[model samples]
Target: MFDWLYVLMKKLVENVFGLSLDTGIGDSVHFFFYDSVKIIILLGFMIFTISYIRSYFSPEKTKEYISKFNGISKNVMASFLGIVTPFCSCSSVPLFIGFVEGGIPLGVTFSFLITSPIVNEAAFAILWASFGWKIAVLYVVMGVVLGVVGGIIIDKRKLEKYVEEYVYEMQMNRPDIEELTFKDRINFAKSNTLEIIGRVWKYVLVGIAIGAAIHGWAPEAALTKYAGPGNPLAVLAATIIAVPLYSNALGTIPIAEALLMKGVGLGTAMAFMMATTALSFPEMVLLRKVIKPKLIANFVAITAIGIVFIGYMFNGIAHLVI
Candidate 1:
C-alpha cells in the first residue's frame, strides 16, 4: 500500500509539479537534469530519513554521548557521522544552527558542518562511479580528517564563547522539532525532498550552466598556460578563483573533465574542484546568517587552508606520475 502511495504520489508530483519525468540519464547525470533529479531524490530521502531518526531518538540524547569525552572515539564517530548526514555545503549553516539549538556538542556539530559540504552524496556517488574507487576513498578520508580536526581544535579553543548572543536566547526557548515514527519518517522524507531540493536548485542549475559552458567553449590554451603541468602556483590560483564562485560536485566535474582534456594539471583542477564544492559564494551567504563575521572569517580561513593543503597534495601526487 505504501509502495502504491509512493508511486501514485510521484505520478501526481510529475503531473502537477511539472518536474521532468524523463527516466534515467544512464550514468552521465552530472550533465543532465534527469540524472540529477534522480540523484537529488535519493539524497533527499536519505537526509530526511536520517533527520527523522536522529530527530526522534537522539535529538536530545546526543548531547550526552558527545559531551562525555573529547578523544579519538568521539572525533572518529563525529567524522563518520559527517559522512552519513549527507547535506550540501549550502545547508551547512542552517544545519549547524539546528544542531547547536538541539544541544549537540560544539565539536560534533562542527564535524558534520565540515564534512557535509566538502563531501556529500552527490560528490561521492558521481566521483566513485565516474572516476574510480581509489579517488572516492581518498576523497572520503581527506574530508573526514578535515572535519574531525577542524571540529576538535575549534572546541579546544573554546569558540563556544563566540557564538552569537541572539542564538543563545533562541536556544533557551527552543521548541520541539522532535522525533517521528515509521509513518512520520515517510512524511518527513517527502517534505525534506521538496525543501532540500528547493533550497539548492538554483545552485544546481548554475552548476549545470557553468559546466555546459565549459564543455562547449572553454579554451585549451588558457587551461594549459596557467593551470597546466609544471605550474606549481596553479593549485593556489584555482583555490583563490574557486572560493568566490560556487560549483557543487555536479557542476564542477564537467569543467574538470574539460580541463583534464586540455592538458591542465589534474592537481590544479582538483584544487579548484574542492574549492568550488567546499567553499562557494552561495554557501557563504547562507553561513553569514548563522555565524558572525568573525566566526565566519575564522571558519573560512581554516577550511581554505585545508583545501590548499589538499590541493598541493594532489599536485604532488600528480608529479609522481605526470
Candidate 2:
C-alpha cells in the first residue's frame, strides 16, 4: 500500500538530498521521513474512522450495554468494547470507577481497563501498516485474550474487598444519551482525530527518532547477542525494562520495527511495547485512587505474568508469522 511512499522517500534521500542510500546517515534520514509520514497518515485516517464509530457508543451506553451480560461472556464483551473505546491507561480510570459505581463486576471492569490501551484501531492499523496483517491480527487476538484471562482471574480470586469503600457509596448521576445525527458524528470524528493526533504526535516523532538512530547506528551483532531468539531471557528483560517507560501503542510500534530490523526477537520487541503501553506507572497511580495497594499490586502482577507468557508464546511461533 505504501510502496510509492517508500520509492519516493528513497528518491528524495538519494537525489534531492544528494546522499547515497549506502550511507548510514542517508538511510537513517530516509527511515525517519518515511516512517513518520506513514504513521501520521495512518493515525489520522484510522483515528477518524474509529472515532466516528465510537460516537455511537457513549460512556453511558457502553456501561449500560456491558451491564446486561453476565459471567465469562460479560468479560468477553468488555474486552471487545475496550478495543473500540480507544482510551489511554490513565484516561480509562474514570470509566473504571464508573463501572464499579454502576454495579459492574470488578473482573469485568478489569477486562475493559486491561484492553483499552493495549489494543485499539490506531494500534491495529499501525501494526498492519508497519508489519503485516498476520502480526496485526495476532496482536489483537493476544491482547483480547490477555484482558479476558486477567479479568477472569481477578474475579475468581474474589478481590472486591480491595476496592475503596467510597466508590461503592458514591452515587453516579447517569446522564441522558444524546441522539446524534450523521453530521454530528462526522464533526465529532474530525475533532477527535485532530485531538488525538495533536496529543500523540510528539511521542510519535520521539519514537521514530529513537528507531531511526537504532536502525542507522546500532550494532546488529550486539542487539542479536542480547535480544535475539537465542536468548531465553530476552522477552523477560524487555518486559521488565519497559515497565518504567510509558507510551501509547502508536508511539511504540516504530521502536518495535527498528528492534526487529536490528535482529531483536519479535517477541522481545512486542513484549516491550505491550508492557510500556498497558502497565504504565501513571496508570497505576491513577488506579490507586479507587483501589487499594494490594489490588493494584495484584493487577500489575497478573498482567505482567500474562504479558511475559504472551511474549514467550510469540517467540515460540515467530518463524511461522515472520
Question: Per-prediction TM-score, please?
Answer: 0.65, 0.93
Error of 1 at 184 (Å): 6.9
TM-score top scorer: 2
Model 1 pairs in collision: 56-179
lDDT of 1 at 65: 52
Give per-residue lDDT, candidate 2, residue 123.
72
List per-candidate RMSD values in Å: 8.7, 1.8
- The weakest ten consecutive residues by lDDT in model 1 span 23-32
| lDDT, candidate 1, 239-307, per-residue tens | 898876664445565456556656787667666767777777777778777667777776777777887
Clashing pairs in 2: none
Q: After superposition, how far is residue 134 of candidate 2 from its true place, in Å?
A: 2.4
Clash number for model 2? 0
**Model 2: worst 10 consecutive residues (lDDT sum):** 84-93
- Give residue 52's error in model 2 in angstroms: 1.0
Predicted structure with the largest lDDT when compared to the true one: 2
Per-residue alpha-carbon lDDT of candidate 2 for residues 242-274, written as tens digits (9 for 90 to 100) = 888775556777888888888888888778777
